[model samples]
Target: MLTAADAELARRETRVTAFGLVLDPAALRDRLAARLPEAPRAVRVDYLRYKPGTSVLAGLVLDTGAGPVRAYAKAFTPEGAPEKLAKHRGLAARAAAGAGGGDVSADWHSVVDEPAHLVVGTARADRRLPGVGQLAERPGRATGPDASVRTLRYKPERRWVGVLGHERPARLLKAHPPARAAAALAGHRALAAAGLPVPAAERVHPQRCRGLLSLAWVHGTALDAAPADERVLAEVGALLARVHAVAPALAAGREAAPARPGLDAAAAAVGVLLPGLAAEARAVARTAAARLADRPRTVVHGDFSADQVMVAADGVWLTDLDQVRIDDPLADLGGYLAAEIADGRVPPGTDPYDALAPLLAGYRPCGARLDRRALAAHTAAALLRRTAEPFRHRHPDWPVRAATLLTAARDLLEQP
Candidate 1:
């Protein structure tokens, strides 16, 4: 069980990142006060994204003398700080001149370029994030008309996803760091060529879309949000079966993410956050590593979850296809089920098991053989890996939530 001391340890560890100064709200308020039009009362910042040693971005509500202004502050490597700030200054100038900037309307885009914070890091991820918005709104592109680019998720210097339209998005945009964008494009093409139910990539003018992957809008409610309907579940099961059978041959040029390292990393993070569960977390990962290796390997969604599934009348479509690579096929199943159970992913008042039964029922007849023991181990590992999520996602009671997830993993492992 996690005591008060254990929770304190977890909170303290969050402040010890490589970019410690950039992640500190107090430091941010001081550093940016001079840059703003008027420095006044206070600043409230929440970590939007943090990738150790690479980048960190914060969303802030600054209490200036004028009023409150919401802005994003992206980290920069010391070597690139001058260049990055210059670029933003240019962006501010353009906006001030009324030319506008990014995907935000020309009228209000200036808010994004001011009161920036600087830090030593790898590169500027925030640079092209707004550019994808520009590409989405431009005419004669893969982006259909009238859709707006709303950021769905962001991990600085890593990857970002934007939905160009809401709920049933008119277009989808996945942006990567300049170095990794090409591989992402290749991965999408490979899946599309294999006749998977992947969304079609839109063809945009090549001039300004360097690190952006734009897709024709996919129309469907997310699977986790939709009712646990039988038809969609069966379709998902069959789709996974096909992908597992065909993925190996198709994976020669694609990425490979083995289960062992990911599990080991998860265990280490849990050890750091909840010392009481360190031994148990290690056991979960070790057992999962051994069991996962015994099974035949195939391409797996490295981060599969209910959110990645889109249920439409025609079929089940997979979103966030960037991590599709070779690994234990059961990793996909374990991940999906782990999120469903731990995240309370099913609709309100619905038991996750009620959803799980029909999903397994649909899965069994689809030519895929599952090892229940391995699935259990992987699910436990998945839960342990996600122990930090509540904290990362800004839950007010993160310590309790993280400890409860750790306990769930232990229970899953201890079960007969």
Candidate 2:
């Protein structure tokens, strides 16, 4: 059924089915034979990232003589198959000289399964993400500087963010495709220029290395990782108000109204990955479409959540500014509310919104008046859009969890 999309995207036949083969360990052991020192003792991988009819990126841990070597592989459409063979080979050679440590090294490889009609590129590091090695060299601590790079997140060909050192990192290095380099720089620079409690941006580029964005680490425990103090909530609320006060030009794009809710792609993704819940996901989308109240747009931190902030004596620091855009202020409020409810910290059998009391109390005084309807609708929209995350994150019982999130979204939209 997925192959039905080939003609539409100009992808090869079985483009979707072929990518699935790469996830089969028995098949991978043979396809990647040249790279493995011997028959792989075992293969560990998860269907971590998938874009139907396009690509799939998965984390891999292979048993080898040296122990489990961590790596990644991306299986993609073969429209430009012939040309990428040489490109991948060249990049693989270049990466062999790049510095790396830990489970995965910088070495790379590629293999094409002609029968599958797909190009599979595998690497210990993200070749598409530029300048990580250079950013890793920056200080990892204020004084002693442990400086070991630890992956915070990875979504191949899209993003790879790593924190330097441990416990308390001194820096965060991000690598996205170069085409998005300018937008990434603008978001942070604008926030910093506005005197927000966000990290200062340091550009990474020189003749020898590729361009990347490096951020001074925000010191303090992240709110999501620990209990969030009321004071921390207040500080975060005040900081967000300041961000909304910033001129719209500070961030370049505007978010679409919820009536045209951006969950269309996410809903479609549900159809492919969790077909049983696809209809409910679509119904939730429709309910959200009619529930949003019109409001003036402001600068919004497009992806605000408890995980996006770190509290310290000096200030509450914000990170992850890539999604900065002009939109309904309630959009951010929704992001926060959705995360709070989804986090499961709220006592069982109690209304989830009770968790937002401290946050909203802190918000109303410093920020615009709350629009209860808009907030409810926006939160539902956020939950709906994120319903696919459980599957994408490789949870073993993802379907049940994903269904719970959908139920929450539907309930939120039902609010009168």
Candidate 3:
């Protein structure tokens, strides 16, 4: 007994609601195709939920038979004046064709200004694998002997299109507040000026409604696959030292604040969904915070980890500059070391104390021996942050890993 308008509204709501439900790429394709009758011939899709706070954007690749074409799609609630539907359609058509270079869908303008081009690029990058389309059709083939290119996706919602080939290092920044994007850009420039290897800034697009400020891509491979050799680690360590050496600038024109609480909050949020280790995890965070309260302040990568570090033919490139801020250097060191330890590549007892020597030698600090107490404190705090990562929509094993990190933190707290 529903009117046609009512039915259409229901359909739109259903698609939006799917964001909360478990994602099924195949099912998503069907829904998308139903909406667009002029569907491309062959299709490949990949979804990734990179981090909490960014929205999810879906990447779809269509084999137009001419060649591969990519597009990104996201949904949003209508806002602003109730203009005529035709007006909205006209605006969408212009924006889609103007910004998307005919690769984007016109339907997207009805929801938002334009689909996030960054997200679209990311999706295209993931689909470049030789058998990705085949893998999509045969789900079981995902683990087969195929050289797959990983897609980088973040949330509250982000998606990209284009082949992000393995060797192409990319940088992704969720610039919710315009200031954050500006700051990230400043940081990247600073690294480049310092003679450190970092990606050049490309573009900044504002997603007003979604509160995203997208930046240009940084090309490189995350150091996630394996621990670097001693020499590589030493070089990386030196790079970190040099990065820290750049005189602290209020790059974002923002004052520094105590980061301990932020780290605690991240952990507490994680603990909420991971009730089993909630108490212990919170305790570890608090202990780390208290211990690092007196650490010397410097520019530290707030969320540094193996994923943040990329190794490329050019050299090591650090991505994710949005979290760049003045803090204890140990925060970066600790978080990275904790990741290494958690990955089981570095034994807990293996002393990395001397590892800094080569790095320091390379950096040639103005003063020998940077503050160790503060470094250790920041390290502890970094571990706490890692232990408290949000688990919603994350893999089932994530919480287990968080719990394991909590255990490691507790052990570190007991040391000396």
Candidate 4:
């Protein structure tokens, strides 16, 4: 017979082993009650974002024995949790005001200046309507292990997304939190002015301590799962070229690139967590760093990958503009190629360079030149960095995969 203590342990283990999460429904209810006392009993808890043993951000629905009310609950061990929560509350208040078409003088800045606050199904006081139409909250795409990076969609074409991870590794962010959101908003506007298909940033709350960005949803399917062909790939290449073309204007009056991947630093970062592979990872980083010297720099999409670009019937559009910055253009190309290669877009033992030929061919005519050495170096760094990411902690085979990528990075660095 299983003891009570054993049963609780098994239940927690199930949560971690199965869903990559350990959530306490009772604790979640208590938090919700504190925030929304008048709301009824919490009948259900949904995990929107879960990083096992680290953090879990969830969506809660309460039934006041009358109707349902929705709210968010976050549980984590990162530093400054109290401050982050306070910031989020401010963001939520601003979002509420925006949705209600209230003045935003205190909390927000307008990017496009259009009324993007009213989501499709939200209750708006329209002179033309008879009764309030109930709006449904839909789940948006999940980016990674950190639940905070996911989206909470109030409508199909509009979303509430923000950076909720506090104290993320320094390698991920060089600028402070508020600056990161402001830069991203700047990127969105610049891309839109340049005639790119990115979504319009509607309302942004970028205070000195914390910030959040809510984008008007651009309807589309993610290219990673889309049925992409040469035509589709060509469109993607052309758009990237267009992005690079506008880098200079975006970076104007702003700080230079936030961080550069130095070989020594990259190796040190990787080795700090995985001591066994420190020597080899550092050696590869050093070689790649030397080869990357004197490469041309431009505004690169810091986190470009197939999943980041979306494909709609009209055209291709990109999302997650948070990492935009001035850097080697090849970093964008290399990051995309690295993701594709890891996802098996390139067959094992086949050169990713060869596989990327058509895309590069499409890009060349758009006035961007391809540098093999720079691309390889950036690609190696991208792969090495992936080994230390939060997502790696959840993957059962991450050890084998990380080692394989490191070896591959060494080989890529060996290329002339």
lDDT per model, in order?
0.61, 0.65, 0.49, 0.52
For every model shown, what is its TM-score relative to the native structure? 0.74, 0.81, 0.60, 0.60
lDDT of 3: 0.49
What ranges in model 1 sit over 4 Å off? 1-34, 37-148, 165-169, 202-209, 346-355
Q: How far is candidate 2 from the true structure (C-alpha RMSD, Å)?
A: 5.2
For residues 21-62, what per-residue lDDT tens digits would candidate 2 score against the true structure?
554566666666765435557666654577666666676666
Q: Which stretches of candidate 3 lie over 4 Å from their true place?
A: 1-20, 23-152, 157-179, 202-227, 250-255, 307-315, 342-344, 347-376, 388-393
Give the number of the best model, judged by TM-score. 2
Please report how far candidate 4 places residue 287 from its true position, in Å: 1.7
lDDT-better candidate, 3 vs 4: 4
lDDT of 4 by residue, 332-387 (tens): 88788778767767643457568677677667789987777778887887776665
lDDT of 4 at 170: 11
Number of the top-ranking candidate, with lDDT as the measure: 2
Q: What is the lDDT of candidate 1?
A: 0.61
Task: Report the C-alpha lDDT of model 3 over 26-101, residue by residue, as the tens digit.
Answer: 4444454544435445455433332223233444455654344454444322331123223435433444221111
**1-416 in candidate 1: lDDT tens per residue?**
22354336535544323244444556656765665555536766544454434445665555655445444566654544566667666655553221212232222232222223353111121454534434423423435554445555555445656666654656777767555676666556667778888887742444654567778666788888998787778778777776677656666666555668988888777676566778877887777677667567776656778788888778898777777777777778877877876676633222234545666666668777776677777777788788877755555576677777777766666666
